[model samples]
Target: MVRPDKVEAVAEIAENFRGASASVVTEYRGLTMAQLTTLRRSLGDGATYRVAKNTLVKRAAEDAGVEGLDSMLVGPTAITFITGEPVDAAKALREFARTNQGLVIKGGFMEGRALSVDEVNRLADLESREVLLSKMAGAMKGTMAKAAGLFAAPASQVARLAQALADKRAEEGGAAPAAEAAPESDTDSAS
Candidate 1:
């Protein structure tokens, strides 16, 4: 028979797992209180890092329909539930672990796919979604501007050529060619 408190905890954990967009499992074997606080602060509102019983986590993972976490739920585990952009959370976790050696990134899951420890590191290596999007937008804008310039190039050249011809014709004489040219018998096609 399971205790009511344990059952409720499992339910809550399962709910969190279900609601989270992604989650990273970590081993907080020797992290101090201050370090944990700092890690949580660094993770900010994008993720929640909490310590849970391995058994409870297993149950919750199963209940939440999440996979690839059973092996990682060993030896004092803490999980980061990422609700916002996974890249941001991964970056924060990676940075925190880099500084605080006590934290170890075991593995993670995203969109029903299992990620190994190295994969998590690779995910952390990626830039934030907003930054990537902005860079792509800038690139697209530049490409559009270049296209617009290309589109107008021929028209602009034609206008310049016409203006130059007009200026040359004006410099030669203000009178029209028909007015200046008299009816001639020599070198005249319409004679």
Candidate 2:
């Protein structure tokens, strides 16, 4: 039979699991109190860090509809429940782990798929959603501009050709009297 306190703890864990958009399991052994406090503060309000028992966490994960998280529930486990962007949460954890050797990432889960530690690191390297969208918009704009330039090239050439033809006709009209007089001189020489 489970105690009331244990049931409440499992319920709380289950709530966090349901609320998180992504979850990263980490090993926080050998960390000083100050280091732990700093790490929690660094994660900010968007993320919740809690040290939970493996069995309880497993039960919570199962209740929350997340499967395959049992393997990550190992020694000194602390799960970071993220409510905001998953990529940003991964970035934060990776950065924290880089500076603090005590905090080691085990693995993570995103969008119903279990990810390895390396996969989570790779996700951290990805640009933010806004940045990716801006890059795509810029690429599309550049392609459209190139197509417009290609479409206008022939029109520009046609305009230049028309101007040149008009100038030639003007020069011929201005010199027509001189051309006619030269023919008369040739006729007089023949006579």
Candidate 3:
């Protein structure tokens, strides 16, 4: 005999779990309502923090095809459903936990993989997606510049060689006239 509201809540949680990119389970035993609100605000648009009954969460996880959350669901648990960037959400959770000792990060799941607290901390240490992309783009640009320089080297060397040959020809051409004039004067003297 499940209540209608509880059934609806389970449905919503299941939907969230299905849609989330990552989800962190935290034990918020000693956190006050105001502190919870502050933490939620800190998570920002990247994550949705919610408190659900362990039984409902279990049912929702099962419905959503997510496994290994049954043991973590015990105690006063709050789940942070991360839909945007997992790194950002992990950073927020880690920072909040540092200041507020009441929040204990149990574990999480990301991309169908379970994560321990140490794993979550590692995730937080990772740079954001945009930062990583920008670094990659910079590296690609540098590689392309080097490739262009390599490609142009032969053409530049050819041009320099042509200029050197032209200069040599000019020098020879000027000397020929002087040599002929000197010979003509010699011939006139000899005659």
lDDT of each: 0.91, 0.89, 0.95
**What is the alpha-carbon lDDT of model 1 when measured against the actual structure?**
0.91
- TM-score of each prediction: 0.86, 0.84, 0.91
| Candidate 3 lDDT by residue in tens digits, 95-120 | 99999999999999988878888999
Give the worst 10-residue stretch by lDDT in candidate 3.
Answer: 109-118
At residue 20, give the lDDT of candidate 1.
Answer: 92
- Which candidate ranks first by TM-score, i.e. highest? 3
For candidate 2, write residues 29-125 as lDDT tens digits. Answer: 9888898888888888889888888999999888888888888898889999999877777888889899999999999888888889999899899
Question: TM-score of predicted model 2?
Answer: 0.84
Tell me which of candidates 1 and 3 scores higher on TM-score: 3
lDDT winner between candidates 1 and 2: 1
| Top candidate when judged by lDDT against the true structure | 3
